[model samples]
Target: MRTKQAVAAFAVLLALAATSCDDGDGQAASGNSQASAAGNGGQGALGSDGDGTDGDGTVAGGGEAQLASVAGADELIRLISNVTTCESPSTDPEDTTFTGVDDTSSETAVGQESATNAEWGIEERATCDGEDGSANGHQLIVVSDMARFEAAFKARQEEEIAAGEGDTRTRWFVGKNFAARIYATDSEERDMLSLGTLGLNCAPGYTAPPNSTTQDALVDGCVLTDFVDA
Candidate 1:
């Protein structure tokens, strides 16, 4: 896990954006709390990646970071496709299809300038409509303005701490232009595992709740590893 303060700050930003999207008239979330920061995803500190500058720096690569002005709904789907290339083709060869990114933007929040600005990319819901799903599969939310986003989250964390409502369990893993909010039903179930030579948190052997939704099952059982690079 990264740190209590950093995770708290990230959670604050994600929670606010997710809430705004969930409540918008035209957009509907799949009722998965794990994707929300205040929910399962909001717990833990970010793990160290050792690739950063100084002590900690932005995760880089994947072309230049898209400008905040151009990081709107129009670019969201492409970004998702570019960033999310981690499907399990070896484990579940039949489920190799990556679903198209859905634009849940309401009419009032359809573009870069809308009150619900589209700089906050869309989420990949946990539930799958067809066969072949991995319990490790997790929904993702990407945002623009990495620096501002982190700053805002940090500010919110300060406010919450001052109010005596600090969350010590929030963890975050961020890269140059992307930040991911991971979810897990139980904190104890999370483990740092290795694939090939790279080590990552999130391993097998998780149990999901009965009647769990896709995202619920995912967060409950699978490793919510970070896919984007630094």
Candidate 2:
């Protein structure tokens, strides 16, 4: 009976040891699974491109340095003036040749002179040289406020249609704080001033020419804003 009891005790010890080993293995497997899941989650947070831009092209953290060195209106004007085709770019604060307003007039008068000047506190025109070594009639209007300028631009288009002026053939290349009335003498000059030197692109689902009413088509589409101030 003593031998049988001793044998029974030994059998119990073996069973307990097996159970403890099984439990340890299970715990280890669970820990490994948890670690793997955590690693996958980290990757998912980075998005597909891993450049902080999501798969759907949503930029993370406002997308730094995306404006290609254009930070303000001055920089944008410089960019326009620096076009290879531009021989002599001159800026005039009181010039109203384009808008047909007097230089001695106030901002209100300037606004009344043309629909394009409705919202600009300051309207400076920058003229550059054409391919023929003459004034190309290309105009760049630098404004104080982008929002007001865009609103005025859209309203002007509507007014033109309502008053029998037809579609304004004037193509405007707009940025964060400026607009370019593209009348370049040639395609090369137009491309350089509009998209080549400025590093601009069309907004999604929008194009130039006919769709010039919205900010997406006019400003956001043409100006790279990653460098501009919000």
Per-model TM against the reference: 0.28, 0.44
Quote the positional error of residue 86 for candidate 2 in Å. Answer: 2.3
- In the predicted model 2, the residue pairs found to clash are none
The regions of model 2 sitting more than 4 angstroms off are 1-77, 81-84, 93-96, 99-118, 121-123, 133-136, 168-170, 189-230
lDDT of each: 0.32, 0.48
| lDDT, candidate 1, at 210 | 28
Models, CA RMSD each: 25.7, 12.9
* Number of clashes found in candidate 2: 0
- List candidate 1 segments past 4 Å from native: 1-139, 185-230
By TM-score, who's the top model here?
2
Judging by lDDT against the true structure, name the best candidate: 2
TM-score of 2: 0.44
lDDT tens string, model 2, 54-138? 4444433333221222454455556765554554566544333453212333546544444445544335556665556744455
